[model samples]
Target: MATSFNEQFDQHGAWRREFSLRLKLLAEWLKDHDLLDAAVAERLRRLEIQVRSDKLMVAFVAEFSRGKSEMINAIFFAGYGRRIMPATAGRTTMCPTEMGYDPEVPACLRLLPIETRLQPQALMEWRMVPEKWTRVDLDVNNPQQLAQAFERVSETRKVTQEEAHALGFWHPETPEDNPVSDAQGMVEVPRWRHALINIAHPLLKQGLVILDTPGLNAIGAEPELTVSLIPQAQAVVFILGADTGVTKSDLSIWREHLLPESDQEDIRLVVLNKIDTLWDALSTPEQIQSQIDRQKASTADILEISPSRVIAISAQKGLVAKVTKDAALLEQSCLRQLEDALGHGMLDQRQKILGSAMARGVSHLRCETERVIQMRKRDLTEQAIELKGLHGKNVSVIRHMRSRIAQEQSEFDQGGSKIHAVRSVHLKLLREVFALLGSKALKAEMAELTQALGQKGLKLGIKRSYSDTFDKLRSHWTRVQGLIGEIQSMLTAMFRQLNAEYGFALQVPDQPDMGACLAEMEEVQRSHLQYLSLGNTFKLAQPEFAERLVRALSTRLRGIHESALGDVELWSKSAAAQLDVQLRERRQSFVRRMDAIDRIQQAAGGLDERVQAIDQQIAHLDQLEEKLASLAERLVSAGDTVAAAQEPLSA
Candidate 1:
């Protein structure tokens, strides 16, 4: 049997996974060879994360009752053998609902209360507290429980005019924009501001995020969704009611929201939903096609795009067909064409996106590695020429050069003790710094912070808990700073000693900006109190939130620790380089004088042997240069393949 569209999507996902792994391996290779600069390697590492973790965000935007949720259920969650999302007969999924898999959090429906939006704190910070969100446990096997849990998104609450104003839902000039007021003048509004469905669905696990948004009001109120989510989405599917063609509200959404945010024409898809209404049993197939083609042309004209971009489908029929395994209904649904578009359009586009991203990261590194290799080859070529020129001379000259070499060797041998002393000092300073920033101590401190943040049943609430936790973390930062200063002092003393004893004037470079290392953590601290409030006990207790907070803080701490270690390593290498330079200068001076003596003594026997030895060294350098060049070529070619590679779905 031919591969189904769903299986093809899985194959595409597997391709991405395989590509990401290859990039990871290449990053390690670059690091191992020291081919790229440290920053380049870091960029590669970050790219690996984006490749591996970034979900293909497909947002479904429409007015209520357009079957947007049903489309999502049919296309992605059909494997469940039933409708997983709440797609009832009437208006369902009233809020801006997001279906995803947060591996850190368990399967549950986390709903943020609409009232929480009125809080002084930013939405993201407010979202951090679990207690602020209503948690509904979801059992996948028990479809009833799952269905009930998801139904909460449609829940509503009634509030007085004053209460609505307090919740930022009422504006005097735009009074009509507020939820319809009853005879008593109380406004009925959605109970939840946002619904996050965390489920163990296959498509979600494969990194698919479906954003089902209601009307403009919800999208307008939620700045995060408009400013961040919509703009970042990989594809935005705008749903239009086939019966209504294009309503005023739909036009407003198309003009105001979707069009402005989605810059890529290919990523934006127009779905004329409820197409089953267009299906007439008495009409010929050509007649139906003619109507659809006209609708497609009209939609394309309205949206100012090619007619091919508009897709007509019956999401309800699609869902029913998939659930019942009825091929006829499925074909009537025209969902296969939509799936084909998604596979070829969005999924194919994702490969290009990943490729372009990877190319941007790897190109410079490849060029630089190639340059370094070529430069080394040039230097070796010069050395080879000089060695070949030294093939013949007098015996007396050779003996005199040997005597001078002996004298220089004695002087070189004497400087070894000073080299040892400098090295010892550098090693001692590095060891002490690593000991102070030991992983065990850092891990223990992080564990304590996690425990404090995890403290349940706090009378003072989440704000106080985070405040206390951050303060403790700040103390650890202070201790780390003090130890870093101590290490700097030791390095300075060591460098000063070397300069005084040897007249080398070696200076320890100033320490890198430690403040910059902890700057991200400090920025988070400045507004830590703004993150949590009195009513976030449950939000604070969520395993996902806890793990995320811990991971973020731990990453910063690790960065600082790594920064300190890097600084030490850099300083040590600098000190050793200076010593090597002085030693090389002394030896070179001795060799130059010895060459003059050899000329005077007329001793140049065995010069051919010297030439042969030099040739062997040149051959070794040539092989190394060739290997480096080959690796650079491979990196560039791999980047090209990644950038251009696409998995074309069967039409």
Candidate 2:
């Protein structure tokens, strides 16, 4: 045999319990890591425990005189014989209150007063002596205790203005304050704030918490109820009189507050109450049916529900019929529909629990992964510190070398004769080199080479910016010549002064011989100039000599020449290796994480599809339940009418 809906529901309930336990463990991990805020962590902890415990909280809300308390008493107690909840012509509940199962506890009425004249123990004793105080508490283990508690809390005697002011129920008196003579001017005191009363009842023990909220106006007037109680509620049922249909106030409740996009969905349930009035309205049967159809259609368009789902109920009649087994009374009443709707709603809650559990599991996993990644990043940063230190040391060594070379060059120039001679030779060679390097013949040869190279190198000229390169080289050479000229001029002046003082002619040497000191320097300049003019440096020994000379000259003056080249090669290799390894590792990690995520998503998807299927089944079952309840009411009503006719004959 296939599993029944209730059986499936029970299984899902059990799964949710297990899931909640796991989520709690995950939340503990998050708290340990300081990954969540304290308040958010606390909320998650509470939600986890709430899911595991599987408690159902039903709030009864409505405008004043809409039979909210009477309905709760009738359905919950099966009759008003004992009057478990106080219901009167005016507002019976002066503040928000709660009732639930706790039979092992003593009966008590806990009051949280804004200001109090009586002590806690004194208020507890006041149930037996209601005329002595404004409120009281009583132990509810017996009928006598229950009666006493109710009487104590319900006593409505007016207090003197002075008494009211003393209790903080009225504004403080002032010199300009005028006392009004009318009863309307008197300040009304709210009886409770955060009261917790224990009731010793059999039905209350079945995981039920009935929140009896004050009327809309009263709730609006109270800041605590609006800010705290309503938000704290896991589920809320808004009751409206069906006899009057949707009123401005009813629409206001939904539009202004309840129907907004809440973080949680499906928390609010709207109840069209007091539907028995429909039966008394005078009209032909056709006219009445047409009106009901029209009203239902209108409601469907407005509330986005099928007319059949909008239950029209008479709370008073349904409670009597449930106990009496009179189908006729039930048929004439709408209470049966309301009961069916509530039952369906309870089943729907089970789905919400399962969804929340799965969501928490996914969230926990993501948070855990993020925490681990952050820790890894910190470790990598510590490892990178060594690289920075090495770079700084290299920069200092290069700078020291450059300073030493500059000091040596200055010392060599102090004699004036060597400086004059070296500068004159350098200037002469520079002029000759420029004449050789910058010529029409060389330019024409370079242009032809460029054109030939362009054809060979993918149809572009040498794959380089020749004009910019030539301009930059010429600018550098010009600056070097100017420096050499300045040195020469200074040396000439110093040498002339020395010659005048000593009366001897000093002869400046010509350019240094290529075969003598710095043989590499002569080879380099000659080879480089040849390359520029002829477009090639094919001689092996000369080219090698050119590279050696350039390195030797620059090394003493700028240590960066050697270190820069070495650093460039080292960084390029290191970067390539590091990037390759990281890329491969990242690819593998990405694949692994993606696979894990895919599996989770697939599992969640399967669960979602199953849940949707179950939801459809549940909806079908609800419709059947509604139809069965309607049929039962009709049958009972017909039987009652037949019995009445037979009674007349028997009499």
Candidate 3:
């Protein structure tokens, strides 16, 4: 049987568990070793806990009066008696609100105030704080309170002008005060600003985080929401009115912000809202369908959708359809496409989570192994230095022996003629003695050393398993590269549109340059021959050993080979102390080079991370650009009439 979405989710859960375990271990090690800063350690601990917890986060985003809150209540809290979230026409959510499933207590409406734009915690302090100033915690179990919350003209606090100005709810006129504004004449104070309500329903606490956004003027007008929230969102659902299949505003939003460009393709879903309006319009069903299809085709051409996956739905009707079993037809007609989109999105997310986790694990293991190997190399280098020193000392000893023999030969030459017979005997003996200490003898010893060195080199050759690991890593990287490329292309197109709309220049880096690093590696490989020259030279030497002696030495070296054959052992011991010192220095150089490579890898990885973060920030900036553009245009238009009014008498 094919794998189900649930099965994929389960696999992701298992990997998450593994990731949590590994992270826990890493945290503990860092703590014990005092390696990480306290704050970082705390963050890791929190992340570990979060990974293990099965909490799902679903955020709702739409223009004001799109019934986002109503949809939330209907889908998750139908059995609950009260409407947990307050949904009304015209900018209902003055601030972003979240709801979830909490069964331990009765339904409650908690209003959180926005004192300043800060972290998510800023709203938490005001949650359930008071009854006035748009702050209230009501018992939602009672239908009366739920109904009261939804009413457009409830007993809500009216903010004074001073309060609005203080809270940054008032529009700024000057260019210096607000970069998003036009020259100093167009400022309008909205009446319904600074009103925020947060409701906690039993269903909300379960696994949903709803963001009830205001209209284009509210959501797009602010840099905070555009630059922070939406880009970070896992999925974005754009709600459009079905009656206005693709309105100027809807198209504007898609073209300016949501559509995938050269640099990004973050998941986006579009819902043609108010589909019930299409049921009995003057247009026939076939005509309406054709219109929708045409619109879809046009949008696909602009936004790059392949199969045209727009869903036509009535948020108001879908809420009603959820309750009755007979409402399947209605529900299917309205929400089946959206359901499919959500399901596919969820499944893709699951795969991404698992894949990222696995990649992280492999990266961690590779780093650890590299560190260990470097340390071992260092130890080997130290030993090589010692062995080189011993070899030098042995050379010095041989030289001294040659000097002594020379002196003896000089003495023998001086006592000539009368001791001709003695001279001849001495000459023969001298020749035999010289032969014992000849270059041939030295070469024989050198040959043995070369063979030992070769054996050591073989040992140092990277294991086949490591090669396999690298191959897998490369394959994984290839996939990541492709995905990143697609995302990058999407972002590029989006950025271009934003630049054109807002008149702000944005230059995106084309495919990042990995060539420099690759070239460096190539250079290193090219120099390998020079690096191996010393060993090669030693191997070329001819050894002058008798058969018996050669056999004896080979057997002896083989016996102690495990201990003294490799570069580690060769450098560790000292037959000639000078040779050992030189070897030690060379080993140190090798270790340093390896360390450099490790640092380079780490730097590259960090660069990749930073690029990803920048991409996210850029997406946020694009959203902000759209909002600012709209506000600026409005300000300019508003200022035009005022300028005319202030003009002197016509010349």
Candidate 4:
């Protein structure tokens, strides 16, 4: 037996819930590790927000009277035993409508004023101000209240040609196709710019958001709908009448609006709706089947999608069948297959999106952190090797250090004068380095650098922004180079003095190359400039430029600065530590020599215990290295699980 629509929806909900939980867990892990930096964190946070807030948006698009609303009714609202959304024939759903559940807001139908279309802000921005919309309370269980409130989508207002133009309805080239004018030359337009119905339904509250959009005129009038909302949806169902598949208006809506959306066909499902219209009273079953097949194939060809994607379904009949508990009629309506397709195809893709986010947040961060741990482990291993080598040659080295200390002590006891001289040199070098390239100097300059990038004319001025930001970064980089040279010179001189005075071998490491650092900044700058230049005409794109550009610069500069500081600090500390160790050896050398002769007598008896202790430490480090390696494997395995779950989404 085929699955019921309710069962499919429930399964979809279950899968989504599990996917959401996994994403939340991944987010928590990333947050704990402090790896969710601003750049990578946004996508992870969006997934977490969508899961927690239940905002998986699915859109239905079609020309007027294509049974798009009916499909929604049958698949989702049929459980109510009647249509919950308006699906009446002949120009129903005049405005674009959205159905979702907002837990914070009361269940209601809110309509934005059509006059607001003249404003420059996006529709999402307008939603923030509740006073801009007309609200009507809704009780979900009450059919009459829902029916009454839903009628607002079909509400119309008479407007003159000038008023129509201002609302984005009348273009000079398409004057003839404008809404049929009355005797007074007044055209009718939708009274509401947009309608949002917040329903208190389990599926809606379980992360199912639906967009029910109208035909060509409504879509063309709204730029935000085409640019932002539709593209962001998990799936788009494009409905067409089976009897008249892919009409001119339908094609227009598909090409002009839906086609431009990202992952157009990948996330799109074309529905040949109103298949009941093709049923003939006298024709044989085979003839009807052949006719429907021909329509599906032709529609697929017209839409440039596979035939398997063009589904035929009688949504009106499907609603009646499900409500009346008629199995045969329900099967005949073909709604079950469509439901499965949506449940498997669309819901699966949604799950993949969540899974991908989890992999990014968890696995990517785990790998980066593990890499740092591995580096530290390597450094520790080197230190351990040095200790082992020193232990093996302890007798001979201590004898030589013993005689040198006796000679030094005769000259001066405690070596206080030598220690003070070394410390003085280290302090002077540190002060000079901090003065030039300290965090204070770098941070103070960043504000002015960012402001210079943001200062522009009425246009985005992408070229000027890039030029100024890059120049500032270059100057900062040059200063860092100069500081590195100064530090390098100080270290070379200081190390030479320590070698001559204390007879220790310590050398300065090569200065970090600024070329790679500069290249990274240039690359980020180019990407930001490219993004801003592409959509410079849109005011919405302006804020993104400022936010992304600053973030890019800050992240790259912070990385470079940290690298420079690490290099300089590591070299300086290593030199000071080596000097101090030599000085301590000089002071303790004679005592250790006397003690070494006694220790040799004692070790002659207890040598085995000491060797055993050394062996245990070696074994412990080996175990630790193995454990870290195993952890890296686990991280990879966890990432594979998410990828495996995503595999079926493409099918």
Model 2 lDDT tens row, 170-225: 33423122223256556455554334456644434434566776665444433223
Total backbone clashes of candidate 1, pairs 3 or more residues apart or in separate chains = 16
Q: Candidate 2: what lDDT?
A: 0.46
- Model 2 residue 360 CA deviation (Å) reads 6.0
What are the per-residue Cα lDDT tens digits for candidate 1 across 391-432? 454555457546756775786578678657756765775666
Candidate 3 per-residue C-alpha lDDT over 39-107 given as tens digits, one digit per residue, 9 for 90 to 100: 334345555655555344445566556656666555454445445456666545555544444554344
Question: How far is 334's C-alpha from truth in model 1 (Å)?
Answer: 0.8
Candidate 4, 440-551: lDDT as tens digits = 6555555555455555553545566557656865776676577667767776786687667655454554555666556656645554454445332332233433433354
Worst 10 residues of 2 by lDDT: 642-651
- Worst lDDT run of 10 residues, candidate 1, spans 642-651
The residue pairs that clash in candidate 2, if any, are: 101-204, 101-205, 107-139, 107-140, 327-636, 327-637, 328-636, 328-637
Which stretches in model 2 have alpha-carbon errors above 4 Å? 1-50, 79-82, 101-105, 114-148, 151-189, 193-195, 200-206, 246-257, 261-264, 281-309, 354-651
RMSD of 3: 33.2
* RMSD in order of candidates: 12.0, 38.0, 33.2, 11.6
| Residue 579 shift from truth in candidate 1, angstroms | 17
> Candidate 2 vs candidate 3: which has greater lDDT?
2
Estimate the overall C-alpha local distance difference test score of candidate 3. 0.43
Which sections of candidate 1 miss by over 4 Å? Answer: 1-8, 31-37, 127-131, 137-144, 175-177, 301-306, 378-651
